[model samples]
Target: MSQHTFLTLDEVASNLKVTRQTVSKYIQAKELNAVKINKSYRITIKDFENFVNSNSTSQEPSISYLRKTKNCTLQYSDKSDDFEVVHGIFHGELRSLSNNGKLTPNKFIFGDNYFVMKKLLETHRGKVDLIYIDPPFGTGQDFNSIDEHPAYSDKLVDGEFLEFIRKRLFLIRELMSDSGSIYLHIDKKIGHYVKIVMDEVFGYQNFINDITRIKCNPKNFARNAYGNYSDMILYYAKHRDNQIWNDIRESMSEEKRKELFPKNHSKLGYYTTNPIHAPGKTLNGDTGLEWKGLKPPKGRHWRYSREVLDELDEQGLIEWSGNGNPRKIVLAKEHKGFKIQDVWEFKDKGLSYVEYPTQKNHDMLERIIRNSSHYNSIVLDCFAGSGSTLRVADKLGRQWIGIDNSTHSLNVIQKSFKEDNINFELLEYVPLD
Candidate 1:
């Protein structure tokens, strides 16, 4: 209940530019005061200051909070330095592929997304508000459309795949606004590793959710494992607690309504009864007082004040049992929809029903855009498979950008956009040499 006033050994070590072992030595030697709480030593700020002041020499600068808090990072064979990844050069240029006859913020880049994203950092850094990308799943296979057209390749595997994603994530983090968020759709096989990579780019505290998306129906494979029917979407914010979150809810279905609001009322339609008291006791409030000669149950407090409870009883909103137990009537119409959870069932259609291979569900994209962005926000999809994210963002009145290296993806996006009467510019990444 109190503000956090203690620091962990790791935090102290990071701030002092030393190791946890060194901080432990200071504690063991009784130089720094610390308390043992739940098997871990927690040093208070006052004591830490005392230790620092007592140890620092006149010639040395006083130490402040100089280092970042320790965080988890994925280690792979070819992982590059974060600084190098952020400053890496891409010898490519964005050239206009087509004009939409009007000035618009929406654009599609038909080129390698890595290079395209690097180019974007020059002007669009910290401008994009939301991003949703569904990259290849590293299955070591080639993807093709329903008509046998080559779509994209997923040749990178293991450490190579991880490094590839890590490099792009560094660039993506730079392109994100302070309040921006990104949702990465990935298969469960490699999603965990990618999550750690994201934690390295975006701090671990910025992670919002690991959404389990039911991508398809149960598979009848003859493997010694459970059916693979789902994938995961890793969601993270550029800065924790700052990204736009609309808290969109899912509408209740007729089946759920019948199940929850089973009782029918003549005037209030379908309704249900709820306990008038909540779990915690209120010792010095009106909720703790008696109402209608009845007090709240033991260890509980009235959900409403006694005056409000009296008003509800007078309005016939409180139902009384034969034994004098009372419950407030809840109308189904007054109930808001169910809160959307991490597990979603927006299944993708068959290959023949989609324009591109591995095209995601439109409803899923709609949910992501509606919840993570606003009308004026800029939505970007670097691995813009079938351009579903861009289309959804456009439909939701948000500006959008799409980037992909696959010509098949480009053609599919162009066709879909034209059919939808969406006006936007197109560009291509041309190599310099």
Candidate 2:
């Protein structure tokens, strides 16, 4: 197997018992990596070896070994129909190291999305609190192929991509618990189409937010407009009334803290209080009662009931301006981080990109995963390109199911997880070996 010497095309043809024309065809096709020296075609011994090794009849082409790694699995506490099972998962005590943390492989799925989906259904369906995915935008990789080869189209046109997403989105909806929400990622190319599809399935009014992510510094484009710089993530729920969303409160800023609580020094944690009344009528347009010597502000009403005010005043939660409106006392720290801004973004904070075109940042993924999901929640990324989504989900103590058709992506994801110390918390490693 030591290929210390190069081989000529004629020699390769002879060795493989192919004709010269067949060998030349491969050379012209760039299928064989050969160098040209003074009109002489020469194949490097390493390139020759790699070519030979990559020619394995497996249905999948081997990828660069040094490029990526992996070792993690999505697990579930319940089971259901429709989800596929991923067999041949390697079982072992192997581990991986990472900068954020270490992990060990607890389970493995050496199969495709449908295969993995079955397993997820068996394990996590109806148990997930949130399901967020950044599916492939239909890049025509073998991963998205239904017939086992790379599709010739970018993604199916005429609602092809729509239907493609619709199928998986429906499954994700089924897998989620009644209180769950789904935040899907897509580019503008089909973001709206995908949204329409999601509305058709998940209901339109259930739509929450359209999250825009800043992926890069804006890659160079030949277009008339500015180079594209963001990706849109659409949020939706199964039922608007059935969704589980916490109305989180953020600590007041230093200025806001002092401005509102100017006379207080309660710095334990920043908090805020509502004034005696809100400058608005009731939701039904009914005004509130007068207090002391003043009627509630015009078109406004008491934010709290007399009984609630009495309780707050008793608990020191009430603030009086002596001559103006009454304010409630709150810890300035009670304000959550920035009121959960609609635009979520991350710019080269500490992590570097994977260098692959269209690769999402792991740092960006961490934010989405943390904000949308919780510990041990079920997360699904059907277009789970690069597997970064799954990697972050695993680290965040979440169980996940990632479905990608690209053997290249699968390889990148696997190797990324394996080589990383991400496998310490894991149970074992079943390298696709």
Candidate 3:
């Protein structure tokens, strides 16, 4: 491996934005190292860099300094000191409810997620691979079940609500592995503020996509605004480039199949013809050479080599039009599914069809879990309402941890898991002195 150049004491002090005396003090205290060169002191770049957390409260300030120096960052009141208040002393224990003589990775914790997630840091810090949370939007209203039973309240609004989510986010960031990703689903009314809060906690550099999800059918309400039919999901990764991404695609619908692949061959079935020549000319390659007394179209080149083009023709995979123009035949059945876009349409079921209030559609959970996580990875949902995310993770062969405070949510989860014959350890949070 290559090594960094050495620096003088004065150079190190200037780089650290501190006095030479402070740098000397750190060197004397062995927090940082320096070599005695001739009559002066010199420090290696690595040795000069080891004094990061010697005086600060945490490593976050150093990270913040580097980020600010390198890129633009968002700033908000109470943002710098917010984590200091919430990140301390988690006093709780995991009480396993139904273990089958083995320690199961899947867990269902019934408690306020703030303390429960902090408690999880002891065992799960930097271990979770994916998290999908559908937290209560700051609507300042209480949600009720179909029978008029109270489900949960979304009464916290504005700054208070944002702080509540922000505190949990700080702890959630600790639980996420370097390769982990989190998706937060919220309504448009408060989604924008939540995005800013997320950028603050997860770093603006790690922010990924603002996915618009069609949550319901179009509405014709008497309100002045346009019909509201969608919500947003803010996706962020612990580290942008390291996050797991499966690149799952969506299957083509019948209408799309008919529109794109209208022609049918007796042996090959539904297919469409694409131009054999693509844009951009190859100066001196096989793609520029003549084939079967025909040259590629002007200002373009053959999509394949001359040998491959002949093979395709021999295999009857090339279509010749009446004007003697040749194109490549693409079969619909052999086509890979279309790439999924940022906008999605997965409507939730009506209230009467769901087990709990605001229960999300399982298909949406399936898509998220399949795309952002892998089999056997740990998936977490601290704001698990009806346990849709946990259930979907189980179905997808991922170990999951679900936490919820509402008794109704817990009851719904228990009933759903029991009916589905899914085995999981149920834990209740107990405070410690």
Residues 1-433, candidate 1: write the lDDT tens digits. 2214666564576466566689999999999999886566788767877888788787554543222222244456765655556666768899997866878889999888788888899989989999999998889999999999999999999989988988898789889987899999999999988988776567566788999999898899898999999999999987778899998989878999999999998988999999999999998999998988988999999999888988999998999999999999998998889899899999999999998988899999999999999997999999998899989888899999999989898888888899888878999989897
lDDT of 3 by residue, 285-361 (tens): 99998888888888999999989999999999999999889999999999799999999999999988887889998
Model 2 alpha-carbon drift over 4 Å, by segment: 1-108, 118-125, 139-158, 217-223, 247-330, 336-338, 347-352, 424-433
**Clash tally for model 3:** 0
Full ranking by lDDT: 1, 3, 2
Between candidates 2 and 3, the one scoring higher on TM-score is 3
Q: Ten consecutive residues with minimal summed lDDT in candidate 1? A: 63-72
lDDT of 3: 0.83
Candidate order by TM-score, highest to lowest?
3, 1, 2
User: Model 1 reaches what TM-score against the true structure?
Assistant: 0.79
Model with the higher lDDT, candidate 1 or 2: 1
Model 2 agreement with the true structure over 235-280: per-residue lDDT tens digits: 8875565666655434456676577645544534444566677676
- Each candidate structure's TM-score, on Cα atoms with residue i matched to residue i, is 0.79, 0.53, 0.81
- Superposed by TM-score, candidate 2 places the C-alpha of residue 95 at a distance from the truth, in angstroms, of 20
Better of 1 and 3 by TM-score: 3
Supply candidate 2's per-residue lDDT for 53.
73
lDDT (C-alpha) at residue 314 in model 3: 98
